[model samples]
Target: MATSRALAQAPPAPARRGQHPGIALTVIAATQLMVVLDITIVNIALPHIQQALNFNTTDLSWVINAYTLTFGGLLLLGGRTGDILGRRRVFIAGVLVFALASLLAGVAQSSAWLLAARSLQGLGGAIASPTALALIATNFREGPERNRAFGVFSAVAGAGGAIGLLLGGMLTSWLSWRWVFFVNVPIGIAIALLAPLYINESERHPGRFDLVGAFTATVGMVSLVFGFIRAAEHGWTDSVTLLSFSLAVVLLAAFVLNERRAPQPITPLHLLRDRNRSGAYGLMLCVAAAMFSIFFFVTLFVQDILGFSPLRAGFAFLPISVAIIAAAQFAARNQVRYGPKPFLVTGSLLVLGGVVWAAQTGITTTYVGGVLGPTLLFGLGMGSIFVPVMLTAVSHVAPHETGAATGMLNTTQQVGGSLGLSILVTVYGTASRNEARQQLGAFLHQATPQQLVEFRATGRLPAPYSSQVLVHGISSAFQMGLVFAALAVLIAVFVIKVRPAPAPVSPSGEGA
Candidate 1:
C-alpha cells in the first residue's frame, strides 16, 4: 500500500543535480525512440519478408499485426506490472526480451518462426514502453524540466514512423530485409546495459495485480482487431467476418462488465468517468485511425503507382517528420497558455484539410503539388494535437494511476489505429473495385484477351480514362480520412473541456 501511495505521490526531487539528469534523459529518450520506431519499422520490409518466407498475402499482415495487437492489448498489464515490480527492473528485462526476439525474427527461416518472434517482441515492447515513460515521469519534476523532456519524447514519438520507413528501406535495399530486425539487437543491448546504471528504480506497489481485467481486455482487443482485419480482406458479409465480429462483441462486452467488478482494475473504470479524459481518448482514436490508414495506403500508392524506389519513398516522408517535430515543440510550449482545446480544434481542422488535399491527388499530380502539402499539414496538425491531448489525459489523474492513464492513452491510439485502418481498408476495396468495374464496363462485352489483361493490370480502363478512376479510388479513401479528422475537431471543441490557464515551462529548458 505504501508503494501504491508512493505512485500516487508526485515524483521525488532530482538526486545529485548537474549533468547526470541530461545523461539520464538522453538514454531514456533513445530507448523510447527504438520502441516507437518498431511500430512501423517492419512495414517497408513486409513485401521482402513475404518473398523471403513465401507467406500468403493474408498472413503477411499478421507479421505487423501480431506485434501491434499484443503491444496494445498488454499495455495496461505492463504498466501495472511496473507499479508492482520496479520500473527499472521491468524496463531492463523488457529491453533484453525485445532484443532476443529481434534476433529470433532476424534469423527466422519460416513465416511461423518470424510471427512467433514478432509476438515476443510485442510483449517485450508492451512491458518496456510504459515503464520507460513512467520512469521519465518519476525521474523528472512536472515543470520546465519534465516539459522539455516530454518535448524530446514527443519528437521521437512523432518521428519514429519516418525513421522506421527509412531504416526499413535501407535494410531491405542494401542488405536483407531481416537486417531491419537485426539492427535492433545491438541498440537494445546498449540501452539495456545503461538502464540500470543511469535510471533509478521506482518504488514498487505491493497491492494486488489486476489479472482478470488484464486477461479480458487483452483477449477482447485482440479478437476485435482480428475480426476487423479479417473483414477488410474478406467481404464484410463472409461467415468468418460475421463470426469474428460476434466474438469481438461478446468478449469486449465481457471485458467491460468484468472491469466494473475487478478490484484495482488494469484500466480503472474511473478514468473513463472523466469527460475530458474520455474526449482525449476519442480524439486519439479518430485521429490515429485516419493518420495510420493514410500511411498504409500512401505506401502502396508511391510504390505501385509512382514507382518510387524504397529509399526514395522512405525519404519522401522526411518533410512530414520535420513538420511534426517542429509543430509538437511549439504546441508543448504553448499548450498551457492556449489550453488544449484550441490546439486540438485547430490541429484536427488542419488534419481534415490535409486529408482533403490528399483526396485530390492523381497519378499525374507531382509529389510536390499532390502529397507534400497535405503531408505537411497532417504532420503539423498531429504534432500539435498529440502533445496537448496526452498532457490533458494525465493532468488530472492521481500519481499511482499515471501508468494506467498513460497506458489508456496509448491503448486508444494503437487499437484505434489498427481497428480504424482495417475498417478503411474496406472503404478502399469498395472504391477501387467500383472504379475498376466502371472502367471495364464496356470492355467486358467487346474486350480482346490482351485488352482485358491490360485492364486487369491497371485495375481500371486503359490510358487517360484509367488514371481518372484510379485516382478517384485513392481520393475516395483520403476523403474518408478527411471526414474522420473533421469529426475529431468537432469532438475536441464540443466534448473536451479544460479550464484555461497560463502555459507552464517545459520540463526541459529548451522550451523555456
Candidate 2:
C-alpha cells in the first residue's frame, strides 16, 4: 500500500526562471527519439544491411542486438555518472559520443565495423537517455505541468520505434541505408547544442559507484543472449553454445552474489521486494520481448513476402504508432481511477489476440488480412501498459534510490527486448532452416540448371519458395510471442496489486 502512494504525486520541484522550458522539453524528447529509434531504425534496413555486409541470417540480428545490449547493460552506470558529474555536461558529452558513433556506423565498410559502431552508439544512448529524464526535473516544476511534459515525452519515446521503421524506409528507399545513421547525427548535434542553453544543471549527488556489479550484470546478460542466438545458428548441443550458456550461468550467479554485498548495488535487490513493483518488472520484460516480433519479423514479411517496397513497408507500420499514442493517452488519464489491473489485463489480452492473429501469417496472407489487425492490437496493448507499469515501478521507491529504480526500469525494458528477440530469432532460424530443407526436396523436382547451381552455392531457394520459408519462420516466431503475452496477462492479474489512488483531500483536510 505504501508503494502505491509514490505515484500519488511528486512535490513541486524548485522553479527556476529564465530557462526555455518548451525548448528544454523539445530537446529531451528529441534526444529520447534519437536514442530509442536507433533500436528499431535498423529493422527496415536489415535486408539491405544483410546484403551489403554479406551477413548470414542469424548474424543479421546483431546489428540491432549490438546497440541494445550495451545500451541496456550500461544504463545504471550512465544514470549514476550523471548523478556524480553534472547532468548537463554529461548529457552534452553523451550527445557528442552518439553523434560520432552514428557517423562511424553510417560509413561502415564491413560487418565488424558496423557492429562495433552500433555498440558504441548504444553506449552513447545509455549515457544520454536516463540523464535526459533527470534533466526534466531541472527544467520543469513537478505537478500538472510536469505530468503533461512526461505525457508528451512518453508519446515520443513509445512511438519512436514505429517512427524509425517509417524513417528507415524512406532513407533506405531513396538514399541509402547509411542515411538512417546519418539522420541521427544532425538530431544529436541539435540536442547537444540546445540542452545547455535551455536546461539547468542538477547539483552533483555524491554516490558510490558499483562498477563491479554493473560489469558482471551486463556481461552475464550478454552471455545469456549470446548463448540463445548461438544455439539458434548452431544446435543447442553445439560446443560453443554449451560454453556460452555455461559461462552465462556462472557470471550471472556471480552478479547476484556481488549485488547482495555491494556497498551500493547498481540494481538494489531490495527494489524487487515489493510484489507490485516486481510484477511490473516481470510483465515489462515479457511485454517488451513479445513486442519485438512485430518490428523484426513482421517487417521482414511485408518486404520479403508481400512485395511491399521498403518505404511502403515503413508506412504500413504508421497505424501502430497512432494506435499506441491514442491508447496510451487514454490509459494515462484513467489508470488512477480504475487501478492498473483492468488496463494490464485488457492490454495483455489485446497483445495475446494480436500475436495469435499474426502467427497465422502465411505466404498467401496479405497485409490487410494479416498484418494490420495484429500490429494495431499489439500497439494498443503496449500503450495500455506503458504508463501504469512505469508509475508502478517508482511507486514505493526511496528518494535516494529513485535513480537506481528508474535506471532498472529502462534497463529491464531494453534488455528484455534483446533477450526476447534472441529467443524469437532462435525460433525463426530453426523453423526457417527446417522449411528450407522441406522446400529443397520439392525444388529439385522443378530445378533448372541455374537454380540448381544457385541452391548448391547458397543453399537458399529463389523467389516464391524463399518467401514461403520466411513466412513459416515468422509464423513460428509469433507463436512464441503468444507465450510472452500470456505471461504478461498472468502476472498482471495474479501478481500485481494497486489500490486506486487515495481520495484527494479537500481544503478542510477531509477526503474529497
Candidate 3:
C-alpha cells in the first residue's frame, strides 16, 4: 500500500523543450520502428535462411516463433521493470542487448545459434517497446502535442510490417539475408547513444520485482504460443501439442493466482477492470490477428504464387504502408473531435471488407484487381484503427500504470499475430489437403492406367493445377481473417464507450 501510494504520487519528468525535444522524439520513434518491424523483417529472409542453415521446413518456423514467443511473453515483466527501475536505464540496456543479439544472429552458423540469438532479440524488444511508449506519455503533455506524437508512433506501428516486407526484400536481394539482422546493429547503437542525451528518465517506483509472477506468465505464454505453432505443423491431437496446451493452461492459472497475491505484480490486474480499456485491448488483439494474416498470406501469394522477385515483393507492400501513414495522420488530427467510436467501427468494417474481397483471389487474378485493391482498403482501415485503439488503451489510466497498460496492449498484438497465423496455417493445411484430394480423385477418374502410373511416379501436379490449390488455401485463410475483423467490429460497437477528450487550454487559460 505504501508502494502503491508512492507510485501514484510520483511525478512525470518534465518535457524537454525546442530542438532537443524533436531529437528525443526521433530517438524514441526510431527505437519503436526497429522493435516493431523486427517481428516481420526476418520473414522475407526465411527461405534464404532455411537454405543456408540446412533447415527442414518444420524447423524454419522456429526462427520466427522463437522471437515472437519471448517478446510477447516477457513484455509485462519489461514494463514493470521500467516502472521499478529508471525507464532510461532499462531502455538503454534493452537497445544494447538488441544490438548485441543482432550481431550474434548475423554471424550465427547453425540453426540453434540463430534461434538463441533471436530469442535474445525478442527479450531486448520486450524491454524496449513498452518503455518507449511509456516515454511518450512521460515526455509529452496529454493533448494535441501528445496526440501528434502518438500519431507518428502509431503510424510507424501500423506500417512497420509492410515496411519490413520492403526492407527485407531489398536487403535479401542486394546483400545476403544475414544483412536483415545485421541492419539492426547500427540503428540500435545509434538509439542507445542518442537516448541519454535527449530522452529524460522517468521517476522510479520503490518496489520488489515480481519474479515469480514474471516467471509463470512468461512460461505460460511461451507454452501457449508453442502449442499453437505445433498445432499448425502437426495435427491438433498430437501428444506434444496436447501436452503444450495442457501445460500452458496450468502455468497461466498459476500466473493469475500469483498476480493476485504479489505485492508488486508484473501485471496490475486493475488495468483490465475498466470496460473501455479492456475493449481497446480486445479490439487490438482481433485487429492484429487479422492484420498479421494479411501480411503472411499476401507475402506468400505475391512471392511464391506470382513469382515476384524479392525486390518486387517488397515494393508490393509500399501502397499499404503509404495508406496507413496517411490514415493515421488523419486520425491524429480528427479523433479528438469525433471521438474514437466512429473511427473504430468504420475502420473495422473496412478491414472486414478488404479481407473478404481478398478471399476472391484466384490463380488467374491480376495484382491490380486481386491484391492491390484489397491492400489499399486494409491499409486505410488499419491506419484508422491503430491510432484510436492506442488512445483508448491508455485512456483514463493512472500515471503509474502507463507502462503496464501499453505493455499489455503490445503483448496482445504480438500474441494475437502468433496465434492468428497459427490458426490460419491450420486452416490452410486442412483446406489444401481436402482440395488436393478432390483434385486427385478427378484426375484419377480421367487418366488411363498408364497415365496414372506416370502421375503416381512423378507425384506432381502440372502448372496451374498446383497454383490453383495453393491459392485456394490462401483464400481460405483470408476468409478466416474476415472472422477476426468482424469480431473486432463487434467489440468496437458493443464494448468500447469513451467520451471525447476535452480541448487543451492555452497559456491564456482559454481552450485552444
Candidate 4:
C-alpha cells in the first residue's frame, strides 16, 4: 500500500519554459523520418547490393525481410521498455545503436554481413520509433501544440517512403548504394547530440517486464511474416511453409493468453476494448497494405515496363511526397473543427479510386497519363487518413500507456505491409507465368519459321510480348491492391466512430 501511494505521488515531468519547443520537435521529427525512411531507402539500392555482395535472387529478399521482421516483431517490447525506463534515455541509446549499425551496413563485404547489420538496424528502429511518438505525448501538452507536433510527425511518416526513393536514387547514382546507409550516420549523430539539450525525459513507471509476452509475440510475428514470405517463393502447400504458419498460430495464441494475465503486459488488453481505437487499427492496417503494395509494384512497373532509369523512377514519386505533406497540414488544421470521421471516409474513398485507376495501366501507358494522376490521388488520401487515424488511436488513453498504443499502431502498419506485399507477389507470379505461357503459345501460332527458330534458340519471348506479359501481371496485382483500399474505406465508414473535440485554449487566453 505504501509503494502504491508513492507511485501515485510521483511528480509530473518538468515543463519547457524559456526554450523554443520547435527545436525539440524538430529533433524528434527528424528521428522519426529516419526510422520510417529506412524501410524503403534500401529498396532502390537492392539490385546494386545484390551484385556487390554476390547475393542470389532468392536470398536477396532476406536483406529487407530481416529488418522488417525484427522491427515489427519487437515493437511492443520496445514501447513497454520506454514505459518502464525513461523514454529519452532509451531514445538516445536507440539512435546510437542505429548509427553504429548503419556504419556496419555501409562497410559490409558479404551477404551475411549485410543481413546481420540490417537486422541490428531493425532492432534500433524498434527501440527508437515508439519512444519518439511517446515523447510527443510527454513533451507537449494535450492541445494545439501536440496537434501541430503530430502533424509534422504524420507528414514525415507519410512522405518518408517517397523521399527515400529520391534519396536512394541520388546516392546510388552520384555516389554509391552504400551512401544510403552512410547518410544516416550524420543525421543520427546530430539528433542524438541535440536531443539532450532540448528534450525532457518522461517520468518512469516501476514495473516488471513481461518476458513471456515479449518472447511469444516477437517469435509469433517473425513466424507469421516468414510464412507469408515463403509462401510467395514456394507453394502454399510446402511443408516448411505449413510449419511456419502453424508455429505462428500457436505462439500468437500463447501471447494473447499471457497478455491477459501478465502483471505488466506489453500490450494491455484493455486498450482493445475501445471500439474507435480498434477500428482505427483495422483501418490503418488495410490502408497501409495497399499503400506499401503500390510503392512496390509501381516501382517495378516504371523500371521494367516503362524502361525508366533509377533516377527518373525516383523523381516520379516526388509529387506524392509533396501532395501528402500539403494534405496533412490541411487535415491537421481543420480536423478539430470538422472531426475525423469525414476525413477518414473521404480519404479512403479517394484511395480506393486511385488504386482502381492504377489497375488499368498497360504496356503502352504513359507516365503522365497512367502514373501521375493515380499517385497524386493516393498521396492526398493517405495523408488525410494518417492524421485522423493517429489522433483517434490514442484518444482517451492514459499517459503511461501512450507508448504501447503508438507502438501497436506502427506494428499494424509494418505487419500489414509485409503481408500485403507477399500476397500481391504471389498473385503477380501466378499471373505472369500464366500470361507468359498464353503469349508464347499465341506467338508460336503466328510467328514465321525464322521467328520461331530465333525464339527457340533464345528460349525467351520477344520484347513486346514480354513487356505485355509483365504489365498484365502488374495490373493484376494493382487490382488486388484496389480491393485492399476498398476494404479500408468500408471499415473506416462502418467501424470508426470517434468525433473530434473542440480545440483547447492556451494559458494566454487564446485557442491553441
Candidate 5:
C-alpha cells in the first residue's frame, strides 16, 4: 500500500514508454484485479449478509446475479464505449462509480439496497475493465513490454478469485462482512485518482452506442433468471413466472434481431459463424455454468454444514488456485504442439468426473471426503479448458475484430454463471422446501422449546434437521451442475473441431 501510495503522489504527467512502467502497470492491473475479483470476494460474506439483511435463500442469489447480469450483458457495449469515448476518461469515471457503489453497498441496510448497489458496481466494472485492458495497449508499445504487462495483469486477474475468498474471510471474520465492500472504497478511489497521472488515453474510434442491444440482452437475461427463481418459490405455472419467461424470449429474440441490424453492433452475430469458435464459446458457457455454482453452494456448505469459520472456509479453497495454475500452464505449453481438442476433451472429462463425485455429497460428508477431490479436479479441468477456449474463440477473427472475439468469451462466462447459478439455486430452493416439509414432523417431535421458538421466528430448523435439509438441496443442485459438466464434455469431444489457430489467447483470467 505504501509503495502504491508513493506512486500516486508523483506529479501528474502522461506516461512515457520508459518512464515508471511499474507505476502504470500497478494502477491498471490493480483496477483490473479489483473488477475481476468482485465476482467472488463477496461469497465468504454471504451467510452474514443473509442474516443481517434477512435474505431468503432463493432471493440471495441476486446478490451475485445482479452484478453478473449487468456486467456480462453490457460488457461488449462497455468496450465500445471506451472506443468511442477516450479509454482513460471512461476508465476513471468507471472506477469512481465503482467506489461510490462500494460505499453504498457497505452501508446497505436491506437486501434490495445491497442488490442495487451491487448492480451499480457491475456497471462500473463493465465500463472500467475493457478500458483498463485497452489502456495497456496504449501505455506500453507492442513488444516485450506489452507482453510482460499483459502477463502481469493477467496473473493478478487469474489469482484474484482465490485472493478474494481469503480476503473476504479475513474481513468477515475479523472486522465484518461490510468491510468486504468497504475495503474496495480506498482502492478504487486510488485507482481513479492515479490513472490519469500514469496512464494515457487511446485515440477515440468512431462508433455508435448500441443502446438497444445492451437493454434487450440485459433485461432479457434478468427476466429469464427471475422466472427461474420465481418458479422455485411459487411453482412452474405461476403467472409471474410464465410472464417473465415469455418476455425474456421476446426480448432476447429482438436483441438478436437488433444486433444483426445495428451499425455498431454490441455483439457481432457473425462471430458465431465459425464452427470452432462457436464450439469454444459453448464449452466456455457450460464450464462456467458448472464451476460458478459449485463455488457458491460449496462456500455455503463449508460454513453452514461443516461449521467452518469464514476465514477457515476461505482457506479451504486455496488448493484450487494452485491446481488451476499448474494445469493451465501445462495446457498453454502443449496446445501449439498438440492442438486444442485433446486438452479440451480431457479437461471436460475431468470436470465431469469432479462434478459427479461432488453430487454425492451429503450431511455426513467431510471436507477431505467431499470437497478436496472435486475441487482439485475442477481446478485442473478449468485450467486446461481456459487457454484452449480463449485461443479458439479468437481464432480466424479479423484483426480489427479480435477484441470483440475475446470480449464475447468473457461475456459468455459471466452470463453463463448467472444463468447457471439461477437454475441451481432454483433447484436448491425447491428441494429444500420439500425436504423441510418432509422432516418437519420428526423435527417437531424432538425439538426443545427454545429450538421451537427459534424455528418459529427464523423458519430455520436447528442443527441436524437444518443440515439434513441443506444437504438435500445442495446435493440436488450439484447434480444439476453435473449435467452441465457433461454437456461441456460432449461439446469438447464432438463439437470442437481440430483447427490450428494462431490467435494469441489474451492473458485474460478465467471468467469469474
Candidate 6:
C-alpha cells in the first residue's frame, strides 16, 4: 500500500481514456447520486418500518444507524480495495450486492431481518460511492468539465437529503413504506448494466489491507457515537456511557499509532498533512454535525409542534433542495475564479447566523417567518461550503489514488455527521431535563394535591412548561451547531492556504 500523497503525486505513463465520455459521466454520477440519497431516504419510513416489523420505538433508530455505521466504518477499506482491484469490477459488484440487499429489506418479515439487510446495503454503498467518484475523475479532464461534473455531484450531495425526505414521504403516503427500498432495485440494475459499457477499469496495484488500522478506527468511531447517543437517552453518568467513551479513546489512540507504522495504511496519514484538505475536512465535519441535527429536529418541530402532517412536513423541506441546487451551481462555477477560501469563510458565517436565527423559533412562531429564512441560509451555506471542499479534497491527486482520496472525503462526512448528531442530542437532552426539573418545582408550589398526583402519574408538565422545555432543548442543540459552524470559519481563515489547482497533465506524461 502506498501513502495517498505518493499515489496522488504519481501519474500513469499513458492515461486511460474510453469512448463516449458523456454516457460514462451519466452512469457514474447517477450511481453516486443513488448511493448518497440512500443515507436519508429511509428516515421518513422508519415509523412504518417499525409498525410493520413490530419494533420498539427506540430500537427503530437502528434501522438507520445500522446502515450509517457500517457504511461509514468500511468506507476507507472499500476505497482501498478499489485501488488494489479494478474500480469497474468493484463498482459492478457493489451494485449487485446493493440490489440484493434492497430486495431483502423490502420483503423483510421482522425487525432483525430488516436490520441485517440494511447493513448489507451499507456495505455495498461503501464499495460503490468512492469508486463512482474516482471514475468521474478518471473520465473527465481536470478543469471546466470536471468542475461542472463536481458541481452536479456537490449539488446532488446537498440536495439528496431533501430529495429523500420528499421521496420517502411520497412512497409512504401513496404506496407502502417498503416501496422506498423497492424503488432502488430498478435504478441499481440500470446503473449496473450501463456502467460497464462506458466506464473503463482503473489500473490495479498490489496492496495489503491495513486490518489493524481499520479495526481500531471503525470500532473507535462506532463506540464514540454510541456513547454520546446513550448519554442522550440515559443520563450522562450511566456506567455503559463511561465505558463506551473509554473504549473509544483507547481504540482511536491505537488507530493513530497503527497508522504511523502500517506499511500499507488504509488511511494514509500524510493526507492529513495538507492544510487545505485538513481545513476542508474539519469544516465539513462541523457543518455536517449541525446539518444532521437540523434535519432531525426540524422535522420533529414541524410535525409535533406545528401540527403539520407527515406529508406536509416533508414537502416543507423543498426550499432547502432548491436553494442548495442554485447555490451549488453558482459556487461551482465561480469558486476557482474567486478562490474557495472566501466561500468557506462566508458560508460558515452564514451557517452560524442561520443556527442562531433558528434557535429563536418557538411554538407560536409562523413557518415563513421562523423557518424558511434560516432554512434557505442553511441550504446556501451548505452548498457554498460543500462544492469547494469536495473540489479541494480531490484536487491535485494523481489518477491512481483518486478513489482513496475521495473515499476518505465521503467517510469523513459520514463519520462527522454521525458523531455531531450524537453530541447535539446529548446537549438537547440535558437542557430538556433541566427545564423539566424547574417546571416540576414550580408546579409543586401552585397545583392542588390531586393535580400534582395526576401530573406525577402522567409524567407530564403543564402545556406552557412543556412548550418552553422543548424550545429550550432545541435552542441548546442549535447553539452547539453554531459553535461547529464558527470553528469552521476559524479553520478556513487560519489553516487552509489558498492556491491554484495544478496544471493539467497530458496522457503522454507532460503538462498540457
Candidate 3 displacement at residue 288 in angstroms = 0.4
Model 2 clashing residue pairs (backbone): none
In candidate 2 the C-alpha lDDT for residue 196 amounts to 65
In the range 1-512, model 5's lDDT, one tens digit per residue, is 45433433333344454467799899998997898789899988888999999999767867877888888887777776666666777789889999899999999999999999999999998888867766766787543455456556545555567778888999988999999899989999898777777787665555567889989988998899788878888899999999999999999999999999988798888989888899888998899899876688888899889999889988998888777767776766666557778889998999898899889999899999999889889888887787677667766665445546656777787788888887998899899999998789898988889888999999877778878999999999999998899999999998888754354556684421
Tens-digit per-residue lDDT, 311-377, candidate 4: 8889999999998898888888887788889989988998998899899999889899999999999
Query: Could you tell me which residue pairs clash in candidate 4?
Result: none
> Clashes in each model (backbone N, CA, C under 3 Å)?
12, 0, 0, 0, 0, 1
Q: Which segments of model 5 are wrong by more than 4 Å?
A: 1-15, 18-28, 50-60, 86-88, 109-112, 133-159, 193-203, 333-335, 440-462, 498-512
The digit string of per-residue lDDT tens for model 1 on 120-169 reads: 99899888888777777777877556666677777778788778888888
Residue 140 error for model 5, in Å? Answer: 7.7
Expressed as tens digits, the lDDT of each residue in 479-504 for candidate 6 is 88888778877887788787655556
TM-score of every candidate relative to the true structure = 0.91, 0.90, 0.94, 0.94, 0.85, 0.91
- lDDT string for model 3 (1-512, tens) is 56654543476444344448788889998898998888889999999999999999998989998898899888888888888776777788898999999999999999999999999999999999999989888778787788888889999988988999899999999999999999999999999888877788787776777888878888887888788778766879999999999999999999999989988788889898999999999999999899988899999999889899888999999999999999999998887798888889889988988898898988887788899999999999999988889889998887777888999999999888888888888889878888888777777777778876877899976555678789989999999988899999999999998878777778999988
Candidate 2 lDDT tens digits, 1-512: 23322312223224343457888889888998899988988888888899998999767878988999999998887776666565677788888999999999999999999999999998999888878876665566543455556666767777999999999989999999999999999888888777766777766555567888888878988999999999888879999999989998988899899989987677889999999999988998899899987788888888778878889988999999998888787876775467667888888888888999999888889889999999999999988888777677777666456556667778888988899988998999999999998887889989999989998999768887888888889999999989998999999899998877765677999976
Backbone clashes in candidate 4 total 0
3 or 6: which has the higher TM-score? Answer: 3
Candidate 5 clashing pairs, residues 3+ apart or interchain: none
For model 1 the local lDDT of residue 33 reads 79
Q: Give the TM-score of candidate 1.
A: 0.91
Model 6 misses residue 332 by how many Å? 1.5
lDDT of each: 0.80, 0.83, 0.87, 0.87, 0.81, 0.82
- Write down the lDDT that model 1 would get: 0.80
* Candidate 2, poorest ten consecutive residues by summed lDDT: 4-13
Q: After superposition, how far is residue 203 of candidate 3 from its true place, in Å?
A: 0.9
